[model samples]
Target: MQCISANAIFGYKKSAKDIHKLEIDDETAFIVEMIFDYALTGKNSIQIAKMLNEQQIKTPAWYKNKCDRRSYEVDSKTIWTSAKVMKIIRDQRYAGDMVGNVRATTKVAKNDNIRVDRKEWIIVENTHKGIVSKEIFRKVNEEIMPIKERSNVAVGESRRQGFCYCAYCGRLLQKENNPVNPYLFCVRQKYDVKNGCDEMKIMTIPLQATLSAMVVKYVSSLIELQTFVKRSKMKIFQNHKSAMTGDEIEKEILKLKQSTISLNQRYHEGRFTKEAYILQKDKIRIQIEELEDKKLQILNGIGDKEAQKEWEKELEEKIEKFKDRISFTESELAEVISRVDVYSQTEIRVKWRFMDFTAKATDYLVRAQKIAC
Candidate 1:
């Protein structure tokens, strides 16, 4: 088959004679063959991955990076994973087939490539020399794929589908649909015990209760902060207005205008020079402009207070809606909570989306109180 020069597939490299043609990479091909052999021996993908990791074999990603330094960059700690092993076992290229349109990207999500249905894939058989024989590939697929599919059947949608994660292994926890009580546990613990992940199983009901309480507490705090900020801003504005009365500002402007009149009369009477009269009149003009600007600012502060009242009302209404919520839907949870890390049945840490905002608000409140004092 033809290999793209941009990034050649694993276990194959571009031919020196023809840049478009692919040649078997002996080192990576042996690894691909070993994966198929393991599948033929009734070993599951997880088991095969564990065996490879124990042997400290470099993964396909590492091989790809070795062949072309720019293709894939992998750390020294990179090890074989079940997903990587399964991908090698299912690759048609190793069976001498040319497969196309196996995955496609859409206009709406250009970066997200989704697998096309098997029936829609364009696969041509016996296109090139194979690392594994066609018969062996067929047998491995027929024997191992069905069992994997059966084990992965979904029972129902989980309420905490994408939010729950294992605190130890940092893997997404899978939901188990137990009849009495549904729970979430780390799937890695089931497959690989030595993977440094503990057995994590937390019931969905108690988790939901914890999340609900956290959300209620968060909403109550936000409402209080909003009220405090509104009142504090109004109080600051009132104190500022009391410090400088509008009547006092008007009197200052009147005095400045009278001084300008006196300066002009002195210049006409030849008591002061033209330049001195002009400079003195300009100074008085500036003082009157400053007092006028102050009056305008005070008037605008009244308008700002009215607008603040409306904004506070709208914010309070939204916060109040969540303060009394007994439970959160999956979509609602996704909007406010970024993730929930489950350490155990009783210990979980929730990261809320508004944490940064809350911290900034608290800082502003402290500064505002300091200024008010």
Candidate 2:
């Protein structure tokens, strides 16, 4: 007989430097061990709950909380209230199996207790390392079977705290409300909390608006750059890749007219399906319209080349206008760039937006260069 410490498996803190130490399979085994330890400790759920809380251990809810900027807290009530623990014990994931579909329900109207039968179970086993010994696991399931109940909805504070950070101080913007106004203050200067900055609390709305305008401006510049590239490619297609020009349009029109006459003869001889004949006939009609349009454009080009050039020039002017307005958004600037740490008022260093945009732009230019050649 061998003994195992529960902490050795689940308690291994995953860090970047030691990420390769654990395999995914081993992690699942560890989770099962954690579950097993909780169930077999011979304590009722509430007693186990208190021990976890007293130790300041993180619960699943606290671990999953995205707004945890400063602290992680787990209430004992959450541990006693969760249905997931019971569900985990019943789950076959811990049993080293892919077992599923243990019950089927009847569709009876107006019955408060609709009938469900356990005969339809499809059990698959030996899928992974067992979380618990089969005998102990099975016994736990049987013991808890009589007390199974539906879960309760968890209640807690929904208002997000410490979400907004100060752009000036790089500290969490503490929330405050007044009858006249509401604001976020840098905890450092206001109350000397950890990582607090000495700057006065900043007003939220105008700062947010200024940042938003800046981001809008920046996006507009990028879009204008993309549009410039599009226009350049379109010019190449218009001048070099045109399918039907002056000489070509004349030849295409003659061919289309001949094809239309031949198709009409086949229709009259009942040599085509009605649908096929109509479809082919309509295609020829569209080809005729397209050929005519091309012919007219080519003929008019002799006199209207200057006007078309002016229209193209006007489009380029619009693209230029869009490039002039790119600005930084407050949220994006603060979050993405972090606060600019100023050691001196006169000396400043600017950090641009993420390298992602620059890399994308470089890749685009490389592809565009290839296309141009």
Candidate 3:
């Protein structure tokens, strides 16, 4: 059984012998069941949290620390938040499933734990006795949760559904369709006005214009860069060909394959530890795969003028659509921009997608300039 931590999760007690063998804590299991029942009655996470707080129910963090002295200390005054309630409701473990690889730490951002996509999550069903039945959990999550989320906005009303956020509280800004002026405001401010930001609101017209202008600028810049590269006769794809010949790539791949065999031999001879062998093998595998892709690119004539022209034409069309107005679709906007932080109409920050392309383009241009010199 894979080691699991049930300390923070309510309604589950971890076994001393094997943490994976989780037992139901009857006391907290009742709360878990009640939360699901509340959801079934059309109560949202916020309402459920409010209800829990009203009842003076101890939070999972508080309960964990009280039960175990060694457990991480939480404030005695810790109260149930909507986020915490939603987390518990969404947890598959409460429905008798063991989930793994739900989150990962990247080498670039070691301290930050990012959620892995649900499709990538490894789940084993009937792992332990459930606090709530799987059917009830699924209905609450898939049916009830989505309905509660969309209960605020009318169908086809949210243009900037997932992208826009409140700069003050960092919560998603909800759209308000006022006859005089439609605007986005921090929804939290509506509930907790004292704690929430009053200044976190922006008119939709200006916000859309800002986003449209940003998209236009981004596409325009890319188009200009492509034109500059073409005019300079420093083909971006051609540079890759010049960097490494097809024969050279094949040779490198062969060397990597040979290294892999040598690594296996060392592992069998007990020279390389299992951890070191696996790590080195993975690195070699990645290098070989990259070399193979380069070889394929060269073979497929990716440096041809037709391919370059097609790529430029695509960018030109994208810019043309957003040139006149904010005609860019959600999918198109999502392709270029990851998020939009709306501080106000005058101060909107956009986190763009395809940042790697910009970095690569700059590197290519610098190398091209050096070669020209």
- Clashes per candidate, residues 3 or more apart or on different chains: 0, 13, 0
Q: What is the lDDT of residue 35 in candidate 3?
A: 88
TM-score, cand. 2 vs. native: 0.29
**Per-residue lDDT value at 315 in model 1:** 60
What digit string (tens of lDDT, one per residue) describes model 2 on residues 83-184?
Answer: 344555655545545444443334456423322233454666664455576777776666643353212211122233434554444434556666566656
lDDT of 1 at 51: 86
C-alpha TM-scores of all predictions: 0.67, 0.29, 0.45
lDDT of 3 at 359: 62
C-alpha local distance difference test of each model: 0.72, 0.49, 0.71
Q: By TM-score, highest first, what's the ranking? A: 1, 3, 2
In terms of lDDT, the poorest run of 10 residues in model 3 is 150-159
**Predicted candidate 3 versus true structure: per-residue lDDT over 23-75, tens digit per residue:** 88887888888889999998888888878877878887776777873455564
lDDT of 3 at 44: 89
Model 1 spans with C-alpha error above 4 angstroms: 1-6, 13-21, 58-81, 104-114, 144-161, 239-321, 366-373
Q: Write candidate 1's Cα lDDT for 140-166 as tens digits.
A: 877666566424423222123578888
Q: Which of candidates 1 and 3 reaches a greater lDDT?
A: 1
